[model samples]
Target chain A: MWGGGADMADPALRPIQRDWLSKTLAGLVLGAILALACSGLFARLNTAMPLGVRGQLAMWMVPPVWLGVLGGVYFFSSGVRAWLWLGAASAFVTGVFYLL
Target chain B: MRSEFVRIYKAVHTWTGIVAGMALFIAFYAGALTVFKEPLAAWASPPVAGRMVPLADTPKLIAGVLAADPATARDFTIHMGDAEHVPGRMGWQVRDTDADDHDESSVRHYVGTLDATGQARIEASHPSQLASFIDVLHRVVGLPVDSDPNRWVMGLVAALYALALISGVVVLLPSLVKDFFALRLGKNLKRMWLDAHNVVGIVSLPFHLVMALTAVVFAYHDGIYIVQDKFVHDGKWGTAFQRQQPAAAAPGRDPASMLPPLELIARAQAFAPGFEPTALQYQQVTGPRAVVRVWGKDAAAVSPRARGGFAALDPYTGKVINSDFLPGRQSTPNLFVSSFFALHMAAFGGTAVQWMYFLLGLAGAWLFYSGNLLWVESRRRKRPRDGGEVPAQRRDVRLMAAATVGVCLGCVCGISLTIVGAKWAYALVGDANAWLLPVYYTTFFGCIVWAFLQGAAKAAVHLLWLAVMAALAIPLTSGLAAVAPGLNMWVNTSLSSLGVDITACVGAAALGWMARATARRVRQGGADSVWSEGPQPCLQGGVPGVGVQAK
Candidate 1:
């Protein structure tokens, strides 16, 4: 997605040795899972609400949660850590979703 | 954030922006025009003959049309206004079954009206699709069709845009306080462009945030609903929105027995006093679960959708079935969600708010365009101290400039020419709807090719001039229509249509000014920059940031 690392030759880029490619891919994938899990948990908690209302709320929740993950995913120092932590968070959320 | 993190975020902001900026330019530019969708539709629609049917006669018109053609009973609308594009008191659309749900271009429009004798007359009107065509471009970032795949691509772009917004704020956090609203119109072109970009982005950060989040939901809401059905609603999502059915079976309801359109509006008005009814949409009127939604705007409240909020009422009893989506009448939770839609669609605070959104949208477009300009300007290599040669610019810089010039200006020219083509196509081919896409794509691709062939510097000026001409043609077409009626073209004197022409005139003046500035830059600006018309020379040593400054 970074498209050939066109600015790789720039001195400013040399210091950042993190795995951007894997981190971005992890953000895309795990962030979606985490978003879906959050939405599922939201729906379960609001099960008593009318489907018309709850469904809309759930659908709208996905973007922010997913984008939140994508935006903050870079805070991790490396792609491996990003994947591990996001993976753990997604698992926790999914477990909570099923438990409800 | 640490300095290292800021630097990393700066890179993130740059890459994400470069990837999504051009597409967002089309989205924001076209989106700005879409704020006046009704006006654009009115401007493009040829005037219909005869006066509109009276509001009192709309019930009769609906009964007559339904009796004549029962298929229309599935869904139809009775417009309450005298807008130029309203066609008549009653209008409905028959959409192609396979067309994307958001695709309005394939829909056939029909209007029912009472003739001189008070008999129902149904006319198939070919209302121009120019407004919706531009809307489709805005929705899917210049895609011709609003299909699922295209929307997913739009979803990707929206995600990238969200990332860019976040990273951009992070990158600016250090200098944000010091440079708030700073506009240094100085010789340091790169700093000037950066300041301008930062100011727009930061000031409109909330607006862009709403746009990005809402756009993501719009692009992927269908999938989200499917997921919601599986994990959230336990696969009952499809039936949840359905109205409750009675146990006793009965034949199809009679349209004539249903309440009049005026009664529905009255009921809606009673439910929410300030909610003005613009149209009465009768859905499944003949079916057991019949619903008549009185749709309109309430200037004081937020609407759930672009068509404004609606109060769903039972056609037989005139009882309000649902006010969940009604403006000024929604529950607090529902209203909270509705605010999102209202903010994104400019469905609140009336025309003043609409104008604000329009200007903000244009400024957003300029933000992205200036980002590209800053990109090219920052990468510029300067002339050597010896003054013997001009350093050759990187291939990426030249390519980015070309793409930026091609895509952004192409969209502007394409939309303008296509808008102007609506009347001409109607005059010549007798059907304007079919010519919209072809004319737009032809102009769009032609501009892109011109950019690549002429190079960014020369093509930017040329395309800007072309854009000026195309935008100017909008009002000229209307002017000619009024003066020379023999051309079979038309002009609408209504405020909405006239507003479109006036806006286009202003747009043309802006484009004209940019064209002049760009031409001067190409002719007399920096010799070592890609924007210059002068020849590039390969040199071993060149001093950076020591040459002529750009505007």
Candidate 2:
């Protein structure tokens, strides 16, 4: 359904009619969980560092990791797979975080 | 990698850019001004009559003031330099608990000096809120107040902005090598706009990335700390940073017996040779955990914070207590994290870097404006080639164009007009600080209404001229104040204040040029585009249908 080049000089090379809604939800919810879990894990692992400094480093790490996930989520082939895979990854990270 | 992935990223980039572009425009524009926030504050404040107390007499001054007014003993700043904004040698602020945490306007300012007979002279001082108002606009994306809700909004915008940056890079990967420094200025307006947008976006990618990340951190830092406290520190984060308390309750230390200001500066300079101590901030000097923070910057090193790093010292012993935040003396790990704050706030490399950041900030604002322009251009419904009736542009496209023009130029007009209004408000009402927000919001919303009532094509030019005139008025008011002493207005001829006027003159000239160019484009350029004046016989020289590739 992506065929229009008569008048417009440039058009899309392929259609991008993916499951945008579910992909967005997965990115927003699961990405945040993963980022928070990773931050907590880092803070826990770096016990040698001062608590203040380590906590600061951990707090600063959340936005970049979360945004990185949000930016990469659309590369998944399907929205359901995107949700399932990200959910499993988040679960693993969170499980480790809780164990610590 | 694949064409399909590129297409998807392209869509992501376009939508995010469209949604966050206008707010980012306001942020970058005001942020550029905030780079010189100190100078703007100096320019806005009227001259005070009190001279700075001599450095040797500061101990007596502090003692006398503290005995007279015990409230200031909690926290107070001793000014070393004589800037126009420094009301007295010693000053402190009493902030209203009801106001927002970030709100500076609700704070009551008091400054103390020694009178002729050596008695303490304390008065309620009124400093200008102009700079802080502009900073609030920058911090919260043109929100009226720097409240928690506004910061959350800014955080969401920053998140979207980060997403856009990533998707934008992905979309441009294929053409990255070929279009590094390419700026094709030809009949193809779309291509020219696209090239300009790409050059600015890619060249300043690092700056934009730092801003996006730091902005999110600044907005939600309270929330981040809460999460960290709950999960990582188990609600004991506060105790870790607290100072070690004495075993028994100690007697109150005397402010009079503390080390002199010069001695404190010497101690800080000895600790870090390159650090220039501008002020000494005494926190709880009368209490058991008395500490003095020597605040200033070392030009050769990256400052840990915007106001600059400080070396904390024991006020009584003249011993350095903490050098972790000192500019040239930070630990390696601290320096790594401070680099992010330094890069975001332009706290390194001094004046040349500040000017570079100013120009880069303007270019960033242009990036957003051009992004919106490209969007409207791509959606333009061209006239039939056979000379049929002109097709009306899509309502969404028209609405977007109007909103972009209104929001962006309205911000320009609002800021300039409010700056000029400061002088008038001071002269007329005797307190310009109280009237800053009313002046800004009135002009901001007024321009928005004007843009909607008059279509985008007309409103863009009108607001541009309004911006030009308003900017020109800044220097003109100063000139009038200088010549006409009868007007009872003040003019500070300090280098920093004059810098504000001179920069405004340059800004006015630039806005004038843009107004002329936009007027020409509306009258004579593409008749079918959203920027055009009205319906016309045929399309102009531009290729009507060729859009920016993958836009």
TM-score versus the correct structure, for each prediction? 0.93, 0.93
Task: List per-prediction Cα lDDT, in the order shown.
Answer: 0.87, 0.87
Tens digits of per-residue lDDT for model 1, B429-450: 8889899999999998998877
lDDT of 2 by residue, B1-551 (tens): 66887888889999999999999999999999999998998889888885778878998999999999887878999988989988889999999888987888778999899888999988999988898899999999999889999999999999999999999999888999999999998877788888988988998999999999999998888898898788778998887677778678558777888999999999899889988888999999888888999999888999998889999999999999988789978887678778889998899888888899999999999999999988887888988989987777876777788889989998888998888888889998898977888888888888887776666888899999999999999999999999997877889989999999999999999999999999999999767877888832122223346232221
Q: Judged by TM-score, which candidate is best? A: 2
User: Which runs in model 1 stand beyond 4 Å of their true positions?
Assistant: A1-17, B536-551
Query: What TM-score would you give candidate 2 relative to the actual structure?
Result: 0.93
Please state the error at residue B100 of candidate 2 in Å.
2.5
- Output the lDDT of residue B167, model 2: 93
Model 2 error, position B519 (Å):
1.3
Alpha carbon lDDT at A100, candidate 1: 74
